[model samples]
Target chain A: MSDFMEQFAELRDQKRFQDIVDAIPYARLMGVELGEDESGELLFSLPFHERNVGNTVLPALHGGLIGGFLENAAMIHLIWNRESLDTPKIVDFSLDYLRSGRPKTLYASCEITKQGKRVAHVLIEAWQEDRSKPVAVARAHFLLATTS
Target chain B: MIATPVNPKVFEPMGQLFVSLPHCATLGFQYLGADGRKPVLKVDWREDLVGNPATGVVHGGIITSLVDTTSAVAVTAHLERFETIATLDLRIDYLKAATPGKAIYCRAECYRLASQVAFTRAVCYHDNPDDPIAHGVATFMRESSPLPMLQEPKA
Candidate 1:
C-alpha cells in the first residue's frame, strides 16, 4: 500500500487540495498555507497578526482562538488525506497551553496517533518563529462520517 | 426541594412544551424571527462584544459559543424539561470580516437529534440573514444525570 505521505503528494497535485482548504472558516481568518515536506508530512502555517490577540492591553492571543486555529489545521490534514471536503465529526479535543502565542507567525504540524475505521486520533503541536519550542499541543479524536 | 425560579411576566408559554427564554439574560440575543416550525434566534451587534480592538471585529470564540449555546436552546425547545448538554464537537467557517459597527444576528437551528446526540446548523449575519458571515455545524451530547440540588426528595 502507498504510504500516507505519498498519497498526500499525489492528492496535492490533483488540485483537489484547495477546495479542502477553502472550506475551513478559520483558514480564511488566518490565511493558511497548506504544503508538503520532502518526507510527505503536511505543513500548515499562518502569519500571526495583531487581531489574533485576545487582550490588546496584554498583547496576548486568546487561548480559544489558538484552539480554533489548531483544530482547523488538524482537520484540514485529515481532509487532505481522505481527499474530500466533507469533515469527520469531532468526538472530543483537549489542548494544553505551553506558552503565549505572541506577535509572530504561527506554524502547526500533526500526526495521526490512531487511525481507526470509526475514529481517528491525532496529535498537533504549534509554535511561532522557532520549531524547537512548541507553544501548544493538542490531542483530538474525530468520528468518521461513515462510522456508526 | 429547591424551587426553580418562575416569573409570570417573563415566562410566556410559546406552546405546550416551550418557553420563550428571556433575551435580557442572553445579552443581545433578542431579534427572534417569526414563530414557525423551527424558530430562529437573532443577535444584534453592540460595540462592547468586539473581539479585536483594531477593527472592532467580534472574536471567533464568542461566535463559537453563541452557536453552541443557541443550538442547545433549540434543543431545549424540543425537550420536555431542562436537560444538561455538553459540546461534542463544533466546526465553523469564517466567510469574511463582518462590517464593523453594524448590528449582526444569528439564525441557529437543531436539525438532528438522536437518543444521545443533537446536531445543529447555524449562520451569523448582519441585518440580512441571507448573507451569512460565518457558518457552523456542531454536535452536542445531552447530560444524563440531574443536578443533586434538583433531585426530588424521597417521600
Candidate 2:
C-alpha cells in the first residue's frame, strides 16, 4: 500500500476526522470548527471575527466567507463519511443568499443528495440564531475518486 | 433602502472603502484602478490562503471572494455611486485550479442595473484573460441610498 493509503486507513479511525478538517489552511484561517449535534450529525461552525467581515457598513460577514465555510463543510463531511484517500474536487458551486450573514457564530450542515462511484452531489444550508431561517443555501457537485 | 441620486465623485473614495474592509485586507486584495471600462482587483499568492497544503494551490473560496467582490465593485461603478448592496445569488464555474505562486486578477462588468437589482458577470485569471481560471455570474440587491459612512480616518 502507498503512504497516502496507509494514512487514509488511519484517518478512518473517526477520532482523527476533526484533525483532518483542521488541517485545511483556509478553514483554520477562518476559525472553522467541527463538532457533533444532538443527533450525532457532523456540524461546522465559524466564530465571528473582524477578519471575516466583508461589509463594514452593514457589518455583515462576507458572502464569500459564508460560501467558503459551507463548501469546506461539505468536503470535510464527504471525507469523514467515505473511505477515500483521494481528496474530492469541486466541479461547481452555486449559492443563494436568502439573507445577510450577520456577524456572529454561524453553523452549517450538509446532506449528500446523491453519491455515485465517481461523483457526488451535496446540499448545504447555513443558519444563524434559528435553523428554520437559513441565511444561505448552496449546491455543490464534486468529483470523487478513491484509491482502494 | 431609500433611493437617491449620488455624486459621481463617490467612485474615487470607493477604493479606500474596499481596502478598509477587514476581509479584503485579510485576503490582501488590491483595488487596481479601473481598466478603461471595468474595475480590476488583484490578490497575490499567499500560503495561508492555500487549500491543498501539499500542492500549495490557493483555495477556490479565495477566487470566489475575488469574483464576488469584483462584481460588487462593478455594480457600484455602473451606478457611479456608493450605495448599499447585498449579494442575492452567485454562480461560479471553475475552469481550472490557480497556478501556485501567481497573483490572480479579476475584472467584472455590470450588465444590467434595474431599479432595485444589479446583474454582473466576472472573469478571474492569472496571466491571460483568454485563459480564465473561473467565471462567475452574480446578482445584487441595490439599496436606494448610500449609507451615512465617512472616509477612513487618516493613519
Candidate 3:
C-alpha cells in the first residue's frame, strides 16, 4: 500500500471516519453501514429477505441492485482512502455476472487498482460468505474534477 | 401502458432487438414513488425469467438490468416516449447482500435530467424495508431508439 493509503487505513482504524453517508437518510434505508476489521480491511454484507422477491419461477436478485452494491462498495472504498467525492465523478462502470448470489448474506470487497492524479480506477467483487469466490465483479473509472 | 411496436429505423441503433419480452412492452413499468426529480419504480423480481441460482437469491444481472432499465424509465417518465436510451455511466453500491428466500423489490429514482443525460438513484431492499442490499446512481443519454442500451457487460 502507498503511504497515503496506509495513512487512510490508520485513520479509519481509529474510527474517526465521517462522511455524508453517515448522515444520509437513505443510508439506513439501504442498510449500509461502514465497518472495518482490526487489520483495516473493509467488509460489506447484505442478508436475504422477502422484499427482494422477483418471481415464483426465478426468485433471483436484480441486476440494478447488484450494480448499486458494487458502485457503493467502490465509492466507500475511495472515501475510506480519504479521497474527496467531488474529485471523481463516475465516467463509466460495468459488471459481469458469474453466478447467482445464493441464499446467504452477500459479501463484497473493493481494491483501488490505480489512483491517478486525474482519475482513479477501482475493482470490486461480490459473493456470498466466501471471499475466495465472487458472484459479480465490476470496474469503475472515476474522473477527477481537477482534470477538467 | 402503450403497446406500440418500436420502429426498425430507431431500433437499428441497438443492432438487433434480441428479446421480445412482454415485460418491456405490454405490462410496462409503473411509476410508484419519487423524491423530487428522482422517480421510484416497483418491479416484480420474477424467478422464471430472472433465474434462481440456489433457493431464493435472485441473479445479480436482474438487478443491474433493473437499474439500467429504470434510468430509462426515469427518462420516459419525463419524456413519455420510447426513444433510444443509452447508459452513459453507472455505479452500484452493495450494502447487505440480498434476501435470497424472497423476491427482490426496488425503488429507482431519477435525480437529475438534462438535455444530454439523466441522473438516477436507486435501492434494492428485501426482508426489511429499512435496509437495502444495494444502491445505485447512473447517467443515461437519450437517443432516438427503441430502448436503452448499457455498455457491453463488464465482468
Best by DockQ: 2
**Candidate with maximal lDDT:** 2
Candidate 2 chain A minimal-lDDT segment of 10 residues: A1-10
What TM-score does each of the candidates earn?
0.47, 0.90, 0.47
Instruction: List, residue by residue over B1-155, the lDDT tens digit for candidate 2.
Output: 42322333665466556656798889899998776446789999998898776678788888878888888877767665446788999988988888999999998888888999999999999988889999999999988226633443355
Q: Between prediction 2 and prediction 3, which has the larger lDDT?
A: 2
| Docking quality class, candidate 3 | incorrect
TM-score of chain B of 3: 0.59
The runs of at least 3 residues in candidate 2 whose Cα sits more than 4 Å from the true structure, single-residue gaps closed, are: A1-9, A146-148, B1-8, B144-155
In terms of TM-score, the best-performing candidate is 2
Q: Could you give me the TM-score of model 2 versus the true structure?
A: 0.90
- How far off is each candidate at the interface, as Cα RMSD in Å? 12.7, 2.0, 13.2
Tens-place lDDT per residue, model 1, B66-104, is 555455555545554445554555666666667766665
Cα deviation at A4, candidate 2, in Å, is 7.1
The TM-score each candidate achieves on chain A is: 0.80, 0.89, 0.75
Give per-residue CA lDDT, model 2, range A39-94, as digits (tens). 98888889899999988776789988888888888877776677767778788899
Which pairs clash (backbone N, Cα, C closer than 3 Å) in model 2? B3-B144
